[model samples]
Target: MDSVNSLLEGFGTAMSPLNLLWAAVGVLLGTAIGVLPGIGPAMAVALLLPVTYGLDPTGAFIMFAGIYYGGMFGGSTTSILLNTPGESAAVVAAIEGNPMARSGRGSQALAAAAIGHFTGGVVGTIALVALAPAVAALAVDIGAPDYFVIMLLAFIAVTSVLGSSRVRGFASLLIGLTIGLVGLDQMTGQQRLTFGSLQLSDGIDVVIVAVGLFAIGEALWVAAHLRRSSQKAIPVGRPWLGRGELRRSWKPWLRGPAIGFPFGAIPAGGAEIPTFLSYVTEKRLSKHPDEFGKGAIEGVAGPESAASASAAGTVGTMLTLGLPTTATAAVMLAAFQQYGIQPGPLLFERETELVWGLIASLFIGMVLLLVLNLPLAPVWAKLLRIPRPYLYAGILFFAAVGAYAIGGEAIDLVVLLVIGLIGLVMRRYGLPVLPAVIGVILGPSAELQLRRALQLSDGSLTGLVNTPFSITVYALIALILCWPLVRKLPLPARWRQRAGTSAR
Candidate 1:
């Protein structure tokens, strides 16, 4: 009841004219940027971070919430119309959505995607409203040791789960931690990695790192692999569902959120897994399984809903635990830091209006997305027709501007280019970028918690595992790290015999 009352108050705050306008602008910008090839929500938020520097924290976050959801919607648009997924989460959509487009059911695919996105986003947000407060209540009791262990788990999870090679992912994380280590030590007042430069003492701004890695790096990469030819996007009419199409979609829409939210709320469980799972689940249950590869409404609906729900789940985790499960959430976490606001257990108590308002804005954003996008999806599709060279040039320009705006220093540009190069190299080597960004953002905080835990225990290493929570989390981390080796172990004779019997 308290949560409900707080949410109603939040709706009041979010529905104010100014905040509503910001939400609208954010949705429009997010969709526009998301429709472009290779630009996902993370880059969109990073590139647009500079725009929010002037706004108050509440308004900025409201806009970010809109942008986050809008990006998911726009990615589906491209996946359906062009068979080009704007981000990895949308890849499943293209498998069936593009086929639907080719087969003259483009409007139906778009409608299913839009409605599914709405359904998943709303359900997930409601779950966040219910779960975040409870989680935050529990999180308030977490000691520094437990927090440190959790961060460690996050580090391991991202590296182990994201990419094909754990080695490359850890390598990327190391690079980010190295960048994070540049600042003066808070406890000892010592300059660890400043390299004798006063500018380095304050450390590299996360904004520069995020923008350089996502925006500038992406531009340079696209420039290198620039294709002279372009494919035309399939024409989509206004997105609307017939009664039959709606009936086919309703169940998948509900099921998608159930699969997505849990995966998204946990550490290292990204949208890719849940969206893929939703796709596979829908395929198995769908009545028209034969139409799957060719153009099944269930395929489009399930994955799209899962993607949106996963995004909301990511946000809930970010708000409650100060942990980010996805790239876009990481960038938004940085945005929170930029406002001198840390997201965690105390945040709801300290920033009640801000928290609730942000939550309410998500609901509002969903409605606006459906109302505007259902009619304007055709216009959004035309965005793909824009030439790549021009789009990338604009990205480069904004990247430089956003980087310089961080501190208004010429040296920032140099740092930006250097990081951009590193980003390009990482991409070339197929290193996943999420772990690196997570490392950069979480490294300092983890360091703080570790020192605090140690200080309290007088430097006894056992202090790290003194608590039940810490012990359990560390055990989980060990299981994650050793699971690959566990898999390589030979099966017991009985199990092997059973497996052979099953095969026979």
Candidate 2:
């Protein structure tokens, strides 16, 4: 009842004329950023951080919320229309969406993605409203051991469950871990892999790594494979889903949020794992399983919905626990700090109005994104018609610029180039890029939690599994790691003999 009243009060605030206009502007800018390669919600928000300096906190946050959802909607547009994913989460969407675009079903693919996002976003927001306070209250009981275990689960899931080969996924994760080690150790105050450079003290920025791997690396590889004849884009009509397609999508759309929200709520959560998991689930359940790698609409629907729901869950975690799970959420955390707002259980008590307003704005943003994206999807598809040379050139330009913009340092550009080269090599060798990105992002945090746990236990390793929750999490990780080997085991001779006897 209290939640209901607060939400109603929030709607009153969010519906004001001034806030609505800000929401519209944010949605527009976020969509543009999403359509462009290399620019994600984090970069868009980071770039616009200065513009919000003078605005009131409520208004600024409302706009930021819009950008978050808008970027998600726009990412699907690029994935479907151009076979380019503006964010890592959208990579799953591109697997089927791009093929659909080539088959002249681009409009259908776009519609599925938009509707999926809307379904997931709306559901996720409701979960946030109901679960955030309780989760925040429980978070106080979570110690470093719990956090370390959760991080381990995330790491294992990404590396083991994502690509075709576990070897390649592990290799990618190792590379990301190595990159993550390139700074001063948080505990010892000693440099581990800096190689005596001043700029290396702070560690490589996540924004630069993301842009280099996804944007610049992709551009260079495409450029290398450029052919003499220009490729033509398939023409797309107005976006609409047939009754059959709609029937196929509804279940996955519902299921995606269920899988995505919990992952996003966790401290180590990121959208990549949830989206991939959703894709695998949809593939397993789909009647047309053979169409998965070709142009299955379920692939696009499930993953896009998961991505949006994960984003919403991330928002709730950020507000309730002050946890920043994804790169974009990290940027928003910084925004909160800029305004001297510390998010946590106390934040709700202290800043009730602002918190509810932000939550309400998220609901508002989802609707605006659906309205904006469904109508403009065809216009977005036209982006595919741009010449290859120009498109690749633009991607590289934005990648470099986004990297440099992370900090005003020239060395950032050098790092971008090196990582871009690595990305190209990974692409050439058929290695999945997402595991590496996840490794780099989560490795440092995991290390911190482990160290904190050890410190608390006076260097006793037993403390790592002190609680029932921590023990369960570790057991889950062990099961995930051993499942593949378990499947490979041969039946015992006695069991085989019994089966043969029964057959005889």
Candidate 3:
């Protein structure tokens, strides 16, 4: 009942005229940017981080919520029309959505995706409202050692689960930790990696790191692999659904959130797995399985809904546990830190209005997303026709401007370029970017907890595993690290084949 009351109050805050306007602006910008190839929600948020610098925290966060959901819908537009997924989560959409377009069912595909996104997002947000306070309540009992181990688990999970090569992922994480170590030591007040430079003592701003890696780095990479010819998008009309089409899509839309939300809440549980699982499940359950691979509406509906739901799940975990499950969540975590706010068990107590208001705005964003996407999809499709050089040039310009605005220091630009180059290198080598961003954001907190735990135990290593929670988390981490080796052990031929197939 208290949760219901708080949520109702949150609606009041979100419905204010100024906050509502920010939500509208975010939806517009997120969709516009998300329609372009290679731009995902994380990159969209990073590029536009500067725009919210002057706004109050509540308004900024409300806008971010809008951008986040709008990006999901816009990415589907590109996938359906151009067969180009803006991000990995949208890949499944291209598989069936593009074919639907080619078959003159593009409008139906768009309608199903838009409505499915609305369904998943709404369900997931409702789940978040119910789950986050409970999770945060449970988290209040955790000790420093337990907190440290949980972060350790996050580090291992991202490195091991994201990329094809654990080596590359860990390598990226190391780079991020190194960057994170650039500031003055919190305990001893000694600079570890500043090299006697005054500016370095303050640490690299996460804004610069985010914009550099996602925006500048991506722009440079696209420029390097510039394709001279642009692919034309398949023409689409206003998205609408018929009665029969809605019946076919409603089940998948419901099932998609069921699959996606839990994964989103878990460490290293990204939209990729849930979306794929939703696709496979829909294929097995569809009465018109024959229509699959040839442009089935269920294919467009299921995965897109899963992707949106997973995004909401990611936000829940971040708010309740201070753990980021995806790149976009990591950047949003940085946004929280930028406002001098920390997310954890204490967040609800300290910033009740902000947390509840943000949740309420998500509901608003969903409705706004459906309304905008249903009518303006054809307009978004036109973004694909933009010339590559012009689009990239604009990205680079914003990257520089956002970076420079951080402290108005000329040196920041140099740091931004250097970080951007490193980002370029990471992308070229198949290194996943999520682990690095996580390392940078969580590295300091992890270190602080480690030192506190050590101090409490008189410097004994056993202090780290003294608690039941810490022990369990360490055991889980051990299992994750050793699974690859366990998989290689001698086993029945059939079991080995099954393992191999699951691994792929």
TM-score of each: 0.95, 0.73, 0.95
Q: Cα RMSD (Å) between model 2 and the true structure?
A: 7.8
Q: Lowest-lDDT window of 10 residues in candidate 3? A: 490-499
Who wins the lDDT comparison?
Answer: 1
Q: Which ten residues in a row have the lowest lDDT in candidate 2?
A: 495-504
Better of 2 and 3 by lDDT: 3
What tens-digit string does per-residue lDDT give for candidate 2 at 221-285?
87787666644445667789999999999999999999888877763336767777788899999
- Give me the runs in candidate 2 sitting further than 4 Å from their true place: 5-26, 29-68, 71-113, 227-231, 240-307, 310-358, 488-504
lDDT by residue (tens digit), candidate 1, 1-504: 888999999999999999999899888887887788868889989987887678898899898889889998998898889887787777788888988999999999999999999999999999999999999998888889988998898899999866678899999999999999998987887997988999999999999999999988899988999878888888878888899999999999999999888888887556777887898899899999998789999998998899889888999999998999889999999999999898988898999999999999999999999998899999999999888888999999989889888878899999999999999999999988888999999999999999999999999999899999899989999998998787842322332342233222
Candidate 3 Cα misplacement greater than 4 A, ranges: 488-504
Model 1: colliding residue pairs: none
Q: 2 or 3: which has the higher TM-score?
A: 3
Q: List lDDT for all candidates, in order.
A: 0.88, 0.78, 0.87
- Candidate 3, 382-488: lDDT as tens digits: 88888887888988998899998899999999999999999999888888788888889999999999999999999999999999889999999999899888784
Model 1, residue 392: displacement in angstroms?
0.6
**By TM-score, how accurate is candidate 1?**
0.95
Clashes of each: 0, 0, 0
